[model samples]
Target: MKKAYISLLLVLVLFSCTKTNKKVDITIPKLTNNPSWDVVCTNRKPLLSFYISRGGIGKRTYIVNLDTEPEFNSPNFIEYKNIEELDKFIVQKRVEKPLVDKIRYYFRAKAIDSEGNESKWGYTRFSLDTDYNKNFMNLTRAKVQNVRVSTGENPKNLIDYDDPGQVSFWQAAPPGPIKPWAIFDLGKPTIISRIWMLANINRDNGWLVDFVWEKSLDGKNFEEIIDAKILNNDTFRNVIDITPVSARYLRLKINHFRGVAPHLNCVIFYTPGKPKVPTPPRGRYVLLVGDQMNGGTFTQLAPYIETLDLDLKTLTVPHYEISLDMLNSILII
Candidate 1:
């Protein structure tokens, strides 16, 4: 037993001496957002940051791994090797499959020096969760119940989504004041986190260049939240992040416009948390119009047909153009 113990001690002493002689002892890279990162859930493409020790010689090669499974053994596990940079990887674009919503994701990284010395893996876990911010001004939900403008042509067009191209916009009527304001009424009080505005880039001075955001619980009383004057005319999209506030009415007051009229193409109000996604209908029910067998008009019977949890599809094509593929997709004739 003493001989065996001495032999083990000799091996340990040699190993310790060899390890100490090495110039670079590569330790695990420190992950900046370990455990959990909220940005991964909110950003479609998130940038990962990390720190590597200073002792590694020559160019460092980073290996990054991402997987849906915690074990990182899934078929979809993605590996990126030979990366020269220590930070900034756009994980979304490189993913093999679309990241499913509300699914936990695993990330790990390691570094190897030119001399083949390697570091321990640094790991993190995050999820593209249900806490995504959503635009509440969607036309489908009719969230912007009503809109009243101080002076503009078709203020309702902002929420109607009727513009075929970029040609349509809400502009102050000619001969009216260059300053125009609009108030939006959400049917119920809603918590708003941010606002997005896309202006017409064609008109240099017609955009919502200078405006103020105001909110009110009652439509009558309003308080200003932001007074913005955009100096960069090159960009069309303007986004403003605000502390989340609940209000029933939101207002946008234009202070100055240099062109013929104050103009804006689109506006979006964002609120935290994703809305529940409705299940897609399994198969479509084709309604062969002009046939006497289907007696009711489309407008009157469309709602009733959807109650069966089936999608309604109207055959707008000529009888000769009706193909087999179309018929196969429909559940009912």
Candidate 2:
């Protein structure tokens, strides 16, 4: 029609002279800054060490577990094209939530990009205490024999398991050290929630004798409750939780059984959920035995111990730091 309108106006003037100059837009910045980074040790377990600012290039890092709220893609969190990939994405930012020696868990992390826009949520503010295996309930018994502390000096009260009277795994020492003690039974009334002792000294080094434990819910009124410190003998593993207390005959009264002799092997107990209780019971249970633990284990690892005697019930002296200050005042960090 007129040379087709001058060949479409010379192809729109060579595509506007090759987009005239230039304007690029891929879009990848919306992590709205927040983690300026500088929280080394929130004391014991709140780790959130950050500081990845070459700003204007971060790619993605959106890990959200806030308690299994789930969503962790993790492409090494794709820091981006330099600084060794944000130093391998800040040595791979970690987000592990598992703690319950008496119930403790808190988490929060956000740093999104790929064009979704995020980054305001940041918290590694301590809440993973580790070792309260479901508020510890049910199991009633975890047998690990090796008792006979007779009377060295750990008992000023309840010692009745069919009349255990004035319980005493007692230990004052210097008389005939055969100290190795252990006794267990919770087969049914467990409201307990913590008591773990796993040690490993290797190399015959002796001098271990630390105790102090007393508990009973029917075995005849006992109540001393943990006192002999200084243990962690070497391979380490010592956890005690009795904050809930509703036991049913668990006695270990050797309050001062030192190393090099007071040899106990291992002892563990943490019950509160899923030991399988729904068949003929009302609720809360774990007595039959066999499911050692597999239903809400924030952290359960054991090895060696030589005289654990734990009745669990301790809180004072960083005793879970007031539940980590109520999980850092309800996550504001």
Candidate 3:
């Protein structure tokens, strides 16, 4: 027993020495203020993986983030105690499929290290996998916004979407109804999650706006998704949160305006919130339009957008035209 214990101790000492010799020690590498990054998706969700893998040996990790806005932005300088918790692998996780859209996105990639340092190789410009089996579907979709609306001089009751008179494609607004214009031909039914309204168009430095939003699957019968109203809110065009509401049509009902600078710079629609069903893989989400069915009207959503998107950017290729087999199929060939 005594001989065996001695032998074990000798072996342990040798193992420790071997480990020490093999370790490639590194001091906290001075972060060169430069940031390197790559984007990847395991489940179709995009993750910005940042890094400062500059002249390093082994892959050491750290933690980072914007302290001001925790929820909006995630920490890039992050380290994981548990490797399992680390979303280190770049996966194309289509856990929640993106909403149907015409505009699309490709791919991006990033990297990070032990020190809270970042390198910038960001936002499009990722290497592709040529291997067929390992290839990823590298594209995104969004409706191209084309319908432009300016204020008019008269106030009309836009509360009635059922009436064709309610909306007039405006070049300019009248003195009344507060130049209400919004583009929501987002293709598929949206569970609107974010609303960014910017009343920053007036050059005169002051503006007041009262706004309400309504939505409907069948454009004729619209209802307010969020009853929250902005009464003379002096906002200089900012992002607002519109909760998850399932609808295809959205109306930005604006009434009672004052002050100046009432221009909408942009309204960016974010990904929908937690949906009812597990989102499918990121692919083409098709919606059939054209209710002109055999002298019958099915009352589909207004502003059939797909046709517009295709029409505006139709390629002069040899592909056959989209026929009855596309939108509304028929008993006849």
lDDT top scorer: 1
Task: Assess each prediction's global lDDT (C-alpha) against the native.
Answer: 0.63, 0.39, 0.38
**Residue-level lDDT tens digits of model 2 in 210-312:** 5656767666677776542334333234556565566666666543444424433345555544332223223332222112221211222111111234422
Clashes, model 2? 50
TM-scores of all predicted structures: 0.41, 0.23, 0.31
Better of 1 and 3 by lDDT: 1
Each prediction's total of clashing residue pairs, residues at least 3 apart in sequence or on different chains, is 0, 50, 62
By summed lDDT, which 10 consecutive residues of candidate 2 come out lowest? 313-322
- Predict model 2's lDDT versus the native: 0.39
Per-residue lDDT for 109 in model 2? 46
Candidate 3, 1-333: lDDT as tens digits: 999999999999999999756634333322222222111123222233332233334464433221112232433222222111134332121213322222223222233434433334323212122232243112111232333243543222211112232232122344544555553655678666655443333232324367777777765687875644567664455455555667666666656455432334334344442212212223333333233311112443333433555433111111112233322332221
Best by TM-score: 1
Order the candidates by TM-score, highest first.
1, 3, 2
